[model samples]
Target: MSVTIEILSGLGAKGPAAIVVEAQGKRLLLDAGGALHPDDTITWANNLDVDAVLISHDHIDHIGGVAELAENVPLYCTPLVAKALPHNRPWHPLPERGTLEVEGITVTTGQAGHSLGGVWLHLAVGNGVLYSGDACFESSVFPFDTPPKAAIALLDASYGSYDQPQAYCVQAISERLDQPLAFPVPETGRALEMALWLAKEADRRQLTLAIDPVIRDNLAALLALPATLRRPGLDHSIRSLLARQNACPPTLQLMCDRSDTPEQWPDHHLLHTGYLTPDRRAELAAGQISWQRWNVHLRASHLVALADQLGATQVVPLFTPFSDNALSAWHGLLGERLCTAQRLYAPSRLVTRSSLGSFACPQ
Candidate 1:
């Protein structure tokens, strides 16, 4: 049986999130997200007759396009994600470390560790294919298990080649606690981790902490889930670390759910916790706007390490804008085994169906 991974979307920060996995004539849609640009069209997933849709997380970018999918298609996602989405149709809750057979293909899921309930899929087909759906290797608040092994790995390399310790970011934020700090993070992914961290850091420095209502809602949702599914005592821990709302200025602010700015405040600094476009970077630089490169996405170094650990023969980088340095690093590590997505799906590619099942990519 031949297996093909069609990158429907999410190759860059500006694009929506979606991936279509086809093997043994079974079609699986990964995430149904809308395009960020008005001119850019959403993926053609709406046109495909997919057997099932696997949502990696509950992020709007990953779920927005779900509205366009055909009716009655089985949607598989975590309970947290299920609760977040509009549910006119029935959605199946994905089980932790569980395997589901879709059209005779074995699909298994593992914790992605990016958001509250993100997942990485292990598709047992011709050659096992591992899809890392916006993964984070380390987080203080979110709990994620070690990724399982697979023959071919599709990874999230959002940071390109940049690699640094998590403490580097924490200390960067800590040094800025002297002034008001604003962190714009997605409600699900790194919001809770950064919020809890900022709360503790603020308390340690005796600064006030104020959370946006949207962030508060996200935290509350995680807390509402079963404790066994969440980081132990995460709820109590964040509450304990939070500064009393009535406290003074020079506060730590977790911003989300709204784009409007506050009328007035102290000398505040802005730090974006996700992807930074070149235009935005230029604006921040010209304006001297305080911004930090804090994110939960995996770097190239992390991807290489994970692939090595998994003993993967072919590594396909996903969610990238084609970073030369990162691709060079991948080439150095995997050598000829490193396969580009284009080459993997090229019509004239020499990689036969049988070779994919073993652990080889077309040269």
Candidate 2:
């Protein structure tokens, strides 16, 4: 058996994601990503052809480029993620935690622990192939399901080798909450957890808090999902926060992310808690805003642990800078397992159906 993996984009930088996997004469596009910022454009979708496209989530950088693909090409994603698809775009149902055959290859889906309806994909090809789509193991509400073993692991390295724990990040952000502030967050990703945390903090500090209505709606949608979809013991907290009313002239606000500038909020300072675009980086350098990570992606230690868990022989860290210094750092961590090539050929080997039993998501 022979397999070819081509990384069309999302290599050596923090940008859009798109990868092509070929096995048994079939091509599967892992993700069709668009530009993260408004001013940017994506060329990977130009004249692209594949047997099928399997989306891992609904984030713009993952599902935003679907509109650019040919309408007849088959697409697959979870029901909740499909809500973000272009209006009336046709799609097949991808299981939230099960296996399905796509283009004569077995594909498995499981919670990515990063956002609602997000999942990591496992393709049963030569020694198995796994793709971690913006995954995290520290989400307060979402759950990260264990994936099957694979010879090649295309992992999310969005955080590079920064290995700070979530508690440290939370404490750092808490210290900055004394002043009136606005946190622009992805409504479907960290907004729900942050809203619950901010609400508690506001109550403790005797400050008023307000959450964006769109974020609130997403919380409701999350509640509507199967209990297994989320982390245990948080439904009550989510409900309590949902029942609370937004305060007028609030001291703290959790709003849906946008192209927000410091001038947009005269009363509150902008405090970013996620990925920083080029514009936001400039603002941070100019001291016009603040940024503290909220752990929506894998940290350094967690990334290594996940790679170990997957038993991956060849690991490609996606969506991060591959500078000389960065490469040296990754070498220390990944050793011989690290793979930075844009194209790779997996060792020829036949995998039996019984070996794929581990692909099942734990109940």
Candidate 3:
């Protein structure tokens, strides 16, 4: 039992990012992703040393370094997740439903319904460290299959919020089936998690679901997670289709659109984020379309309960600085249970002023 963990990349508001796992005189770097800090210090450079790199999912914040990592170490992830990675990468993939043993550590991939290839890692150290990357509590669609024997559980309590009307949100969205609703959320990660629940609700109520093509495509790759993850009692019917076809995410049946014609989609609703701004909201409002903003994060009650269930008394903030949104929120949720990020960054000072000035957004 020789494991000395170090906070590698993610510290603050950063979700499901990297960590330096050291044991038996060997170092394994977990999930190297970009930093979404206040200053944007996340560099897309190549800087890592490990036997292999294990990715939880293909989220930008989680696997931003996939291409960069493939440039170095032997990369391992679920086959679906490997496909979702950048096309430019040269990855020696360690496919899903198995373990990758390098330098005596057995890295296993478990289904983390947050996204395809979304997995939590298990390592046996002095006691153990089970790294759960961006996971939610047990639900009807997906259940909690994370390792239960972790002495040191690096759980994801991202929704460490005081409140966010989840019940009300589900009801509100369900009631708007007659009116087209657009829930323009981010095209990955937690957004997908929310979509899983919504898709199930839509199926149960016999409502059509319209989603962005980008969203559907990403979820299609993850349809195989149910077969691989046999634990936690997956919805046998919906889970069965995933193995047969991409039915649960509804990628093939989705009505993707760039227009706001609510009349045509009388029985359907669109889910997006930021795309439904005030101006666009007005245009859709008159056409039998209902517009509202819903953020899916964890409530303080849920966070504490999750932490308690994981037997975690000390919760560490990852990928964020000292003054990150997640850390600030956790103050109210965990208080004494909260822990500070290990090493933060200040990338601007390291580079030249001219080099920084040339950083302009492409049109």
Instruction: Give the best candidate by TM-score.
Output: 2
Per-residue lDDT value at 11 in model 1 = 60
The residue-by-residue lDDT of candidate 1 on 15-125, one tens digit each, is 677888777767888888765533556755656778888888877667878888876888888887776677675788886556777666777776676887777777776
Query: Which consecutive 10 residues in model 2 have the weakest lDDT in total?
Result: 354-363
Residue 178 in model 2: shift from native, Å? 1.0
True lDDT of residue 209, candidate 2? 96
RMSD of 3: 11.2
lDDT of each: 0.68, 0.89, 0.53
User: For model 3, what is the C-alpha lDDT against the true structure?
Assistant: 0.53
Ranking by lDDT: 2, 1, 3
Q: How would you order the candidates by TM-score, starting with the best?
A: 2, 1, 3
Question: Which scores better on lDDT, 1 or 2?
Answer: 2
The residue pairs in collision within model 1 are none
- Tally clashes: model 3: 20
lDDT of 1 at 162: 69
Clashing pairs in 2: none
TM-score of 3: 0.65
Q: Which stretches of candidate 3 lie over 4 Å from their true place?
A: 35-41, 44-46, 88-99, 138-140, 163-165, 185-299, 319-337, 343-363
- Once fitted onto the true fold, the runs of candidate 2 whose alpha carbons sit more than 4 angstroms away are 348-363
Worst 10 contiguous positions by lDDT, candidate 1: 354-363
Tell me, by lDDT, which candidate is best. 2
Please identify which of the two predictions, 2 or 3, would achieve the higher lDDT against the true structure.
2
